[model samples]
Target chain A: MELFQEVILRTGFLALTWGQLVMWAVGFTLIYLAIRKGFEPLLLLPIGFGILLANIPLTPLMTPGSGLIWRFYHYGLEWEVIPPLIFLGLGAMTDFGPMIANPKTLLLGAAAQVGVYFTFFLALLLKFTVPQAAVIGIIGGADGPTTIYLASKLAPEMMGVCAVAAYSYMAMVPLIQPPVMKLLTTEAERKIVMKSLRPVSKLEKIFFPVVALFVICLIVPDAAPLMAMFMMGNLFRESGVVARLSNAAQNELMNIVTIFLGVSVGATMPAATVLQPKVIFVFILGCAAFMLATATGVLFAKFMNLFLKEKINPLIGAAGVSAVPMAARVVAKLGSEANRKNYLLMHAMGPNVAGVIGTAVAAGMFISVLAK
Target chain B: MVNLESPLSGKILEINMEVGQQVNEDDEVIIIEALKMENPVYCPATGVVKEIKVRIGDQVNEGDILAVIE
Candidate 1:
């Protein structure tokens, strides 16, 4: 009788708290957002599962070394190991041909990262300290894994909130980018069409990774882990000989790592830690950072237009966010809205890939200055 | 595994190889016009083209076999 009573008492069914329940609800909301709305299901689904597992009463999922999920969180996420692995997958999937086709798009990539620094100052103004501000500022980059990796390293306590903010904002790129893009460019600028991209030669395609490796590594050694892995993946793809390696990186290796990365990152959000005023600020600041990034890209493109004879389509500027295909599609959709015949997908891709490189460099910068 | 299949459901514009012709991987075995893209059905494996399934201007699906290599 006593054993039965003790078992019942110790069971999570008897110990549910309001806060935990609220967290469970938030987890479900994330799942719904991913499943029903189709907002980054590959990431959000695993993240939602992590949130659910972490909040279950009496579970040691996040207790470190005790629970299986907790072990995943500790060895993979907390130590900042999984993100770089995920970068390998991302690198393999990336094609730098578009960026190679139009080398000028590199400037838009650099311009987009200005928001990260600007937001870093803003977070500092909010009294989050310099390291916290750097993590917070990275939300503007709209690269979830990079933001999460940086936040986990610079300010471990802020990891839960900052990661959620970064990912949510990344998923919301379509919603957030349009308003900022519309605000920055004139109707004529939106309608302006540039000439078709010159067909990039196979030689230039091969040369790109070498130049990028040298420039990015020399300029930002901190970004080397992510950028180097990314460039290596791209090099393997472009090299035309390593079909086996590229295939593994793109399919088998990437798919395996993404599952682990998504779930472990989601597990960081414990109710006791995630539901705070600072978290709210993280979300707010993250939105501002994203908006600032989009606006910066558009405005920079406009600035460049003042000197160039051939008009550049400013809509491609918004592809400066590192969301890759999504950001590029948003640019194409917006361009179509302005003019039906405008085919901006290929054009936007140049900056879209460049933005991925840009964000990695920015993260490397933050890590160099603030990593403990 | 090598997948020697037509890219689209269109007639083969031309067949440059025969049943005994040796070809390398990614070598254009057939060309099919679909939409605006000149879809080239490349040899997925480096081997002798052992069979040709269709002549020029025959419709094909994405998985429809155009030829066999061995």
Candidate 2:
């Protein structure tokens, strides 16, 4: 009878709690969204699976040293190896031709960062520490890796929630952006078709990364690590001499780092930590940040139109939130709906790519200001 | 003689000139598409199109010869 009792005590069922059960349900929901809804599947699938593994009562998957997921989280995230490498991959894949063709769109990118500062103050009002608030505020930039990078540095405990919030908002771009975009711009503004961009010269394309790197690094040394990696990746791609390195950066390196990043980020989402009022507030503030960022971009474009001779479709301004091709595509689609003849995809790409640089700069600024 | 090559890797979406056609410098010669963006390949010099090397839907890489002009 004593032996039987020992076996019962050792079983997982004996140690299970309601919180763990709820976390399992959360994991299942994330998996369902990834599979059924196709929401950020590459990252969400691993994250969901990791959450499930971590939440199991007797599992060692998330223990300090012995746990597999914990090892991935500690080495990959805590040490801050993955996010910058992901930036390298992003730089490899990014094409700066559009931004080079039209230098003015950089303003739209800067404009989109308004939400970051707005949310910074809002988080302070909500009683988060300066560093924690800065991390939360970066969700406005709508760049997942930057958010993860900043959160891991500034507010380690809030890293998982902020990463989730940033990605969820990124995935929800199609749903969240259209309403804000429509509410902000008039039909005429949306329908306005801008002129085609001048073709950028090969020499300009080759020169851009070096010049950009020099300027950004000099201005914001704190952002140099990510900026340097990103610029180096861009240099590899544009220099056209290192196809093998560029290909590896874009494909194999990106895939490997993404897997580690997703699972490790998931491991941070234990029910005890994730199910709090602060987490909920983070989500709400995240939505607000996205909306505000979209609005500010559109507004800034409108402001620029007042001075420029050739008018731009204000819808493209919404692409400044750094959701990359998705936000740009959304602007293109909306522009087409407003006027089928207007093709805005290429034009929107200028600001879309610019937003990536802008977000990195903003994170660097925050780190410079607050982390010290 | 002028050698025409694609500036990037992509599928040839269209060829705007025929062999033996007269072309001006900077004329849009072909459309190469990569990463869902279309790039127009231009002629380097005013010349007669001597040969067309790539067809519509042909996959090309950077610096691959696409045409010969004389």
Candidate 3:
């Protein structure tokens, strides 16, 4: 009879708690969103599967010393390897041609950072600590690696939820951005097609990452780890002699790190930390941050137009919020709808890529000011 | 031959016309899905599609010929 009771107690069904159940629902929902709705499936799918793994009763998947996921989390994230590696992959694939061709669009990228500060204050008003608020504000930048990097540093406990919020908002960019974009700009402004970007010379392409590395690192030394890897990857692509290294960085190495990064981030959630009331607040604040970023980007472009001789499409400014090609495509759709003649894909890409650098700078600034 | 080139690189979500089908300029004959958004690629000029170089779900880079019109 004692052995029978022990067997019953050992079964996972008897050991299940409300928190685990809740997390399962969350995990399954994320999985459904990824598989059915196709919402950032690359990250969300692994993350959802990891959530299920960590919640299984008595599993050592995330147990500190001996667990499989624990090792991934410890080395890949806590020791700061995965996110920077992801940035390296991004840099390898990035074409800075558009941004290099029209450097003025970089101002639009800088303007989007205003939303991060504004969201930071909002989180502070709602009673989050300075470091906690800083992590929340970066969701506005819409770069998942930067968000995870900042979360890992400023508030490790909040990492899982904050990363989830960032990815969710990123997938929702099309739904959230168009209303604000339409509200702020008239049809004429959207239809006003700017001149095509000048072809950036190969020399300029080779020189960009080098110059940016020197200037940005000098200003924000705290960002050097991520900045260095990013610039290195770009040089590999542009040097025209390292196709093998560039391909590996952007493809094979990238895929391996993405799997580990997703699973490790999801493992951090478990029930104990992620079930807190603060988690919900992270999602709410993240949405507000993203919307504010989009609004500011569009508004800033209109503000810039008051001085420029050749008018720019304000829609492209919203791409400065930086979900990479996703955000740029949204702006492209909006531009074409307003006028079929507008081919804003290449143009919007300038601010879209610039936004990545802008957000990295914001994360570095936060780290410099707040991290001891 | 007038080649109907893709303006953007993306997966061909749908090819609205087949070979030997008549098409007109500005006809939204092919849809390319890039980053989960469906973008309609208009017919570049009026002609019958002599050969369809791409099919649904094929990835085509910018300037890749989707079809040849003559």
Off by over 4 Å in 2: B1-70
Q: After best superposition, candidate 2 residue A284: deviation in angstroms?
A: 1.0
Residue A278 miss distance in model 1 (angstroms): 1.5
Task: Assess each prediction's global lDDT (C-alpha) against the native.
Answer: 0.81, 0.88, 0.90
- Report clash pairs, candidate 2: none
- Evaluated at residue B35, the lDDT of candidate 1 is 35
> Per-residue alpha-carbon lDDT of model 1 for A80-183, expressed as tens digits?
67788778778778777678767888889889999888999999899889988998888888888788788767887777677778778878888999998998
Candidate 3 chain A: worst-modelled 10 consecutive residues by lDDT: A192-201
- The local lDDT score (0 to 100) that residue B52 gets in candidate 1 is 86
Q: lDDT tens digits, residues A24-94, model 3? A: 99899999999999999999998998888888888778889889999999999999999999889889988
DockQ of each candidate, alpha-carbon based: 0.03, 0.06, 0.26
After superposing candidate 3 on the true structure, give the runs of residues whose Cα lies further than 4 Å from its correct spot: B1-70
**Best model number under lDDT:** 3
TM-score of chain A of 2: 0.97
Best by DockQ: 3
lDDT by residue for model 2 (B43-64), tens: 8899999999999999986568
Clashing residue pairs, candidate 1? Answer: B9-B60, B11-B58
